[model samples]
Target: MRRGRVLGALLPLLLLATGCGIRSTDVVEVGDPATVEVAPGAQQGTVLYFISSSSPGGLLPVVRQVDDPSATSSSGTGDDGRSRGKQLALLFMGPSRAERKGGLRSELPMSSDQVSVTTGQEGIRVRLASGVNQLSELARQQLICTVAYERGQGTTVTVLGTDGSIGPARCSV
Candidate 1:
């Protein structure tokens, strides 16, 4: 009877502990900040920025640059120039769209051993670790950053590296 009682008591504690799982919801609207999708194939050598979404009346129509292999070849540039490094920026609005209204404004900055990035009005940041070849794959391997935003909330942003590995970070915001 004692053994049964102890096991029963521990069962509730285990259930309670396991029931506390972390979840996240993106508040930003779509098509505002503009989403930038970087597939593993698209990443070459240069850093890339992806805008998941932005607030209204915010900065629209951002310009992103990607290095062209053909241009480098024609110009006879060195290997650095020839490298498939590319940068992508997106413009969220056109001339007419700029006239629209604005939405809530917030900012989230992310930094890691590998790279540092600042996000706008989301209260979230993602930093990459150095010597990372695959980000997506690393997401499943380790805790990367400590996210700070919502109290009693723990979150994590996993980067999909070029090689298919997920980069690590700890997020609580």
Candidate 2:
């Protein structure tokens, strides 16, 4: 009888100390995805064009961040040509310090202020002070890829010179 009383008392003490049969509940609320607003031009990253070290003179597209808001174009809407113009300006500026360290370089002429890009119904139209036909194959590829990426991939693009149409190319990458 004494042993039975001790055993029963010990069981209750164990349950009380262990918090047995107690339940915990927590509730959290999350924001709605549909209501989120993202501005295209105000984005934090840059889509820069560079020459590839591995491909033996191929264009390498690098999407990295920039501190300056003016470093890239806000051309996602395809309504304004100024966005494309901004992107072209960045292209002509050449590779960043980090990119040069990584073996990237720009083939496009740094002094070509006459190069301008505009969006149209068909695709992007690039006006070059220099003849489009004069551009090296790799240089042309750099222009095509950079403009295409900003305008939209797979979009058709044409190069024009003061003389006339240079050629038509697509942004395949």
Candidate 3:
């Protein structure tokens, strides 16, 4: 009788601890898929690109479309538009492997002509310049000026400077 009484006393506590009695809700759809819409009067061209501090060379050609903002084009805007040129080069020179792997690296600063330069703990903040889409002529100019002014010796940096300067910077890595 004592054993039966103990079992009865533990049964309610065991049930509460199991959490099996909790109710669940059904999954429901929340929103529709995203779509890209192109604007009018956009120009098409290719831009050379590279990522900084990356090994094995990250240089490539990228195509971009400049929206005229008044044309009747129906393509996607900004990053979603189709390329008129070749591959888009991407360069990355963030924290080094040692810094990332060992967790001892500091953030670096960056900026371009299109964007104002701002300093932060990790590095400089960059924003898109006005009337610029992708790495075009104007973008290239701003990037060149910004890099020339902000980088330091022994720092891993990547840039698409005018006059074929990208080759040397990439080789430095």
Winner of 1 and 3 under TM-score: 3
lDDT tens readout by residue for model 3, 1-173:
99999999999999989877797689888898885422211234222233333424322222223344222122332222112111111112223354346332212223323323333343333333333233443334323322322133222223322333231221121
Write one digit per residue (lDDT tens) for candidate 2, span 1-173: 99999999899999988889797668666776565322243366657667887755477777656676444656355445565666677788888798889888887888546666766677778887765566777777788887776555677889887667745787544
Instruction: Give lDDT tens digits, candidate 1, residues 1-173.
Output: 99999999999899888876856667876565665542232222222222223623222222223355242111222222112111111111111232323331112222222333333233223334443452232222222221121111244344433344342344311
Residue ranges of candidate 3 with Cα displaced over 4 Å: 1-9, 16-21, 32-48, 54-173
Q: How much lDDT does each candidate structure score?
A: 0.30, 0.70, 0.32
Model 3 weakest 10-residue run by lDDT: 82-91
What ordering of candidates by TM-score runs from best to worst? 2, 3, 1
Count of clashing residue pairs in every prediction: 37, 0, 19
**In terms of TM-score, how similar is model 1 to the real structure?**
0.19
lDDT (Cα) of model 1: 0.30
